[model samples]
Target: MKLQLETIIIFVQNINRLKSFYVDLLKLNILEEIPSEWLLLQAGGCNIGLHKMGEHYPNKSEGDFKFDNNTKIVFETDQDIRSIRASLMNEKVPMKEVKTFDNYPYWLCDGEDPEGNVFQIKQRKV
Candidate 1:
């Protein structure tokens, strides 16, 4: 048996806002969207699905669908890590200082979506 990871459904307060961040700021290709409901975007080999909180749980608006800090979405890029950080900085996107792990030998930086979903821009040392 084999399992393949494909889509990750993240719940957000505002679908449009997250959509714009992923589509406009991050320049991810929009796979599909149903205004105020959900939006799907191309994440290299995978797909990310963003769903509206209110649509899913009409009664839970007390930060129930906020981004989980425990999980970090990491995108491995072929581009230089510094270049990636610079591009994100040019767009005014909040990002932590890029650092390298001495043991693993990879450059990584943490960033967050408008709703605070932690994500990383990383490149393996080559």
Candidate 2:
């Protein structure tokens, strides 16, 4: 038996806000959405789904962003990583500087989604 990766579901506090962040800021296409419930987006070969968290979930809105998460979603891009980083920063999205190691052949940058989930964008060095 074989299983293929399809979707990554993120439990979120505000569905619309996350939807806008992925759709408008990240430029992901929506595959399916149920208003304030669940949303599925086209993220290249895989899909990203945003699920509204239950009322019992704790809301973290009063502290500095803790980069303590274990998972980071990455998006490959053909454009310049610096421009992408700058564009996201213009929208107030917390983004890190584009970096590449001495032997690395790809330029990469990391940023946070509206809900503080970490995401990275990479462009192959030409």
Clashing residue pairs in all predictions, respectively, total 0, 0
- For model 2, the stretches where C-alpha displacement exceeds 4 angstroms are 1-65
lDDT of each: 0.70, 0.75
| Model 1 TM-score relative to the real fold | 0.46
Highest TM-score scorer: 2
Give a tens-digit lDDT track for model 1, residues 1-126: 122344566767888888879999999998776788868789998788786665334443334233343344657677788887878778877788989845755687776677767677667788
Q: Candidate 2: minimum summed lDDT over ten consecutive residues — where? A: 61-70
Model 2, 74-121: lDDT tens digits are 677777778878888999998877888777677877778998887778
Clash pairs detected, candidate 2: none
